[model samples]
Target: MQIRPCADAFYASELEPWSEYISGQQGKDPGYDVLGWMIEETHKRGMEFHAWMNPYRISNSATAFATSGAANHPAKLHPEWTMKYDNLLIYRPALPEVKQHLLNVVDDLISKYDVDGIHFDDYFYPYPKGGVEIDDAADYAKYGAGYSNVGDFRRAQVDEVIEKIHNLLVAKKPGIVFSISPYGVWRNKASDPVAGSDSNSLQNYDDLYADVRKWCQNGWIDLVVPQLYASTSNVNMNFTKMCTWWNANSFEAKLAIGHALYRFGVPAEGAPYQTLDQLSDQFRISRSNKNTCGSFLFNATCFNENKINILSRLAQVYADKALIPVIGKESEAAPAKAGDIAVEGRTIAWKEQPGMRYAVYTVKPSSVEGKWDAKLTAVLAEPSWLAPGAGNYAVSVLNRDNAESELSQPVKVD
Candidate 1:
């Protein structure tokens, strides 16, 4: 599960430190941190927590929000660093201050929370509106060093941000994955010599100024989840065709398909997410490819609402709980073997290994040795794990990259 901590002004958040710019000062805090609660809850369910954001966007509409202190907002403080386009206030990527502010927000997240990954979707430059000009002439003139054209310069700014963030993640926390889910089509075949996809729609490079292909080629991110929100049958943005393209192109990052679960049973002009089966088919198609790591649903609320029986269809696909796919540099290390396993009452403990996490598994006492259908009880940072019940328990060492070592001998407890 992922929480949009630093989203547009609509969400009342405590994701960032509560000073003057957060919801806390405005009396919007619900007596708890939303991101903290989400992280704990998601971990309890044995799922990874990804902190997500739509960078550059401060607001989605024209209505001026009443912040606790408008002067405290970076948008208000540095008005020149932002642009008003499509009725939204967006931070200009070219500005050094704007890029630094975003980097600081990410730094705050990593320092404060224990998120498995950081996510950014395609919200770089606003979806274009005809005749709506973004006046970044001063920024372009000052900062456009290597690029001749403004378009290329804008793309470079976004690229720099991605590279900087990747560097920060590697330096501060190497295990934490950095991912971007850019718009599905990176570039059409007509646009670039290396572009392979045939879909002729809003390209990430041309329209949004997001050079996704460059990021992948340069190893700037750990995962690239292209928002393949189209139906497999849609001619413009075919899901199957795009998945094939992404898998072939994923250089250093793992490819995870972002399925548009929210669109299930929704109407459209030429293509509709007609049924739950459409999403199921997308899942199956993603799994069929060797490069495909996993998929992420658009929003978690859909499962809660059980929109158009999607939860049930998902249940069929996810019959068993699975570990998050290890990626990036972390996946290369195999953790050392677990040692000195012991159990007393309802507690299980093992000798600690350097830079390793412990995965505790439990099976029935009477279960056959070879037929040991062990279920993962807990993955703890510490060597000790609380025994779930009266079952035989085994422990293994999981390394920084999530690689698990061979299981130690099982200890039976009454």
Candidate 2:
């Protein structure tokens, strides 16, 4: 696995990325398993864990390189696989070795952990630097023999990596989701004319060489989250227009809106972010599209601060905890329902098949007689649950795709 080892167990192992991290404050804890611990904890709360990775980015800045990179680091071990731009290090995508290394990293992650998905962000090729160009002409000459333009050749290289990784995931762990969050605009009408967003913005296709649309078209990914960060009023890239464009372009993969929560209460972001109902407004539009599954916030910490009460508003919008949407034809079949539901002493337990999550619900009084109002309490990975207080409860088996089965026989506490 290309993931940096932080556990104390790796201190004596050959795979330790560097001795510095293991020896420093953040790393080399007595017996801390950072990544594994995170996955375990997340699943315990009935949440799916997706390991987010940036494929090409090696270093954020010169300071990051010096502090993080060691003699054992890939940048130091294989300098030929790296490109330095703006005091940053990026892996060369054209190299076959580089692609294999990325695949190896993914294989290592999914094999060793119970992660639900593998996630890739917008970065493919490095973002363009003004008046500066990526110097891959020589490699293009060797690899792009038949192609006239280097840009087309560069895109083809990226596409091949994405497809290969998708294939690997399907072969190794078919249950694991493959997801990508790319820049909102794929291309502008001015650029493509036939099939493109109406907004004028930096495009993933023309700029970053990330063809997220094609990935969805080919069913190469399970989910597509477009970072529609601009305000609704902005003429350059209106939020609604960008969102609609993405929903329209949504092919086989599920669509999700990426709201810029980080901009909330920031004066420079203009009035939209400052407005209290901005996020809800965007979410309303998201629900308008049947293909839109849900929405993601830019910075999760934004909810912690509750700046402008965005978190409180979200609590209202998402009153009930909903299961993640199931996608693809294969995911359509629902698993067998949970059975033998019982509340023994303090625990509520059930019997279900393997690789299933429990959707625990609280049964409340209904307006009509002989009926009950059930609210989803939590999606639990474990077979048993402990309720907050004595109450009526029900459990349902949620398959990996969250294709929920029929409710188990309801149980009431005395």
Root-mean-square deviation (CA) per prediction: 4.3, 3.6
Tens-place lDDT per residue, model 2, 1-414, is 123322112223333252344445322344666567777788777788877766877666646666655556665678787777677678788988888887777777677777788788788888888877786776787788877898888888899999998899888888788888898899999999988888888989999988888989999898999998887787878888888888889798989888889999878878888876887888888889888998878887787787787878788788878888775435425688888877878688887578778888888768998677888888887899888888898888888777888777679875
* Candidate 2 runs further than 4 Å off: 1-31, 62-68, 328-334, 343-347, 363-373, 386-392
| lDDT of each candidate versus the true structure | 0.77, 0.77
Cα displacement (Å) at residue 234, model 1:
0.7
TM-score of each: 0.83, 0.89
How many clashes would you count in candidate 1? Answer: 1
Residue-level lDDT of model 1, residues 219-335, one tens digit each, is 999899999988889888888999999999888888998988778765662345767778778989999999998887887767777767888888999876565668776734677
**What local lDDT score does residue 339 receive in model 2, on the 0 to 100 scale?**
86
Model 1 TM-score on a 0 to 1 scale: 0.83
Error of 1 at 194 (Å): 3.3
Candidate 2 — what's its lDDT? 0.77
